[model samples]
Target: MKLLPVFIFSFLLNALAVKGQGADTLKRPIAVQLNVGTQGIGAAVNYGVYEKLALRLGVNAIPIKANDVFKISGFNSTSHVSADFYNIHLLADYTPFKQQPWFRLVGGFAYFLKANGNVRIIPSDDYKYGDLTLTEDQIGYVDLNVDWKGLAPYLGLGFLKTFPKRKFNINLDLGTYYLNKPEADIIGTGILTGNSSQTEQFQSNIKNYRWLPILQLNFNYKF
Candidate 1:
């Protein structure tokens, strides 16, 4: 009767208070971010899940190459090196200190779509085989390729707020990723055929190359 209406009114007031409290705890519900770092240029979307927790989905890529950078003793050659790294990741950001929301703990996983490094060395000097000079095609190149394309775990710290009180903010992330075991191969043409035999040794030497360090800057826009 009359009591029921009063009870409903009270419940509605309580619900409104709870909703207001939640809205105060979080500044923004969604954000878009741009990243630049050792991992390269990337973009991410962030969603606020709680007062001090957020989740982000991001993608990044880096492609680099250099020419004539390596030299073998007693050999005249031109060398080229190149690397392509790309990944898609999901990360959780937790801010422990309510007073210092700028500092956060980050944990996540990334799947490397492409992670490869390669080096190629080609002989530029003419080779004399006995009394005859070999053509450029006769003295080909040696190529070394390494790949670590798989799932990797990431642990890091984030500086600055996950989302700004205003519309835009900047943050820094420092962390490292533990990469999976790698597979390597060596390819050679012409007189470099014997280089393939060194694959096993190279793999052993690089077996411990499983750390990917990250120092990134993120520019965020809250929506």
Candidate 2:
């Protein structure tokens, strides 16, 4: 993951050199972009290699956490939920119509450095056995974890041109990433130790949760 940016930068420099030697009429230019959306905030470098074709290399990260957002149907508990995702991607933008430069078909693949979700559930109220109240540690907690870390393919559409006519431009990307299958596990402590048996069922239920939707807005600056 640490070397990804170096590779992308090297590739961008090579593309620039090639563009510099091309014909003056060729619409090959380089741009830098910043974006934000469901995938989180990120930045990318855009290189126009042809009049209707461009390439982008970028990285994105989404880290979110919430408290008391989840609960068991018949249990009184407080849950902490968190999701963290980090990826590096390379994308191609192709304009199918010369007259419609503002519309583009986007295809890409991302390598996720980290993709994980966690839920920790703790009993909110004290439990009593006969006349004795059980301590929190005696009642214990349950932790559910899921990881989707691998290559994901992206397919989307872009609105607005890949490059600015002058210095800056704004665009939108509407897409979805099909993530790899996830690995899930359940851990329990103290009285909840038996919850670990549900790991298999949890994995089965989340097998199909691979689609990650993206609605991103990009701000571009031509160089």
Candidate 3:
């Protein structure tokens, strides 16, 4: 329900006696998720904290197309919106009906690092924060650039296996939030609309505003 300012995640740290598995019914699966391209190099590690639960930590950089963003805000606005993220998550996995379609829900908390950008909407040549000067071009073209860099929550769904032996657990998750309620930011309610209050302008930065869908492919080595 809240986004913490920082993320500290540990890998599959449980003691698995059977080569790559746990001694009993428990196991810690240390893994690495990679981005197929050079532009997106996101990586993460997950753990098996409980039979029906897992936790993870990851670091990723997600950037929106400058031209696409410019189309929405004209050429004068840039978003300092939180896009670059260093996050950690705690998830709850449940397999209610093991005979039906393979389904799992992962929910957890994470810290959103302040986004870093090169297109400036805010002029930075005149401002200074912690020993660095920012350019307006580097800030992009949005007026309300607010970053929730402390804490945030995420939830996603994925598949554990297909048919028969449940060979692997391939997953795809989308974090379920933009920012905490009542918080001030340049998205969601913070965005103003004419004619009506029903608008979808703040999806790119409030919480789970990934530039692209988060695709995770995992290989479970069990004993």
- Candidate with top TM-score is 2
C-alpha TM-score for every candidate = 0.84, 0.87, 0.48
List model 1 lDDT by residue over 141-222, tens digit each.
8998899999887778999999978899999999987787889989898888889999998899887898999999999999
Q: What is the per-residue lDDT of model 3 for residues 1-223, given as tens digits with 9 covering 90 to 100?
A: 2232122122112211122343365544544444322124555555555444455565655654443243333333333432354454444444334464467655555565643332223432354556866554433333344344556555556575311233334454533533343222332221122212221344243445333234555444322
- For residue 80, model 2's alpha carbon misses the true position, in angstroms, by 0.6
Residue 138 in candidate 1, Cα distance off native in Å = 1.3
Name every residue pair that clashes in candidate 1.
none
Q: What is the lDDT of residue 165 in candidate 3?
A: 35
Superior candidate under TM-score, 1 versus 3 = 1
Q: Which should have the higher lDDT, number 2 or number 3?
A: 2
Candidate 3 residues lying further than 4 Å off, grouped into runs, are 1-24, 35-41, 72-83, 115-144, 161-169, 181-223
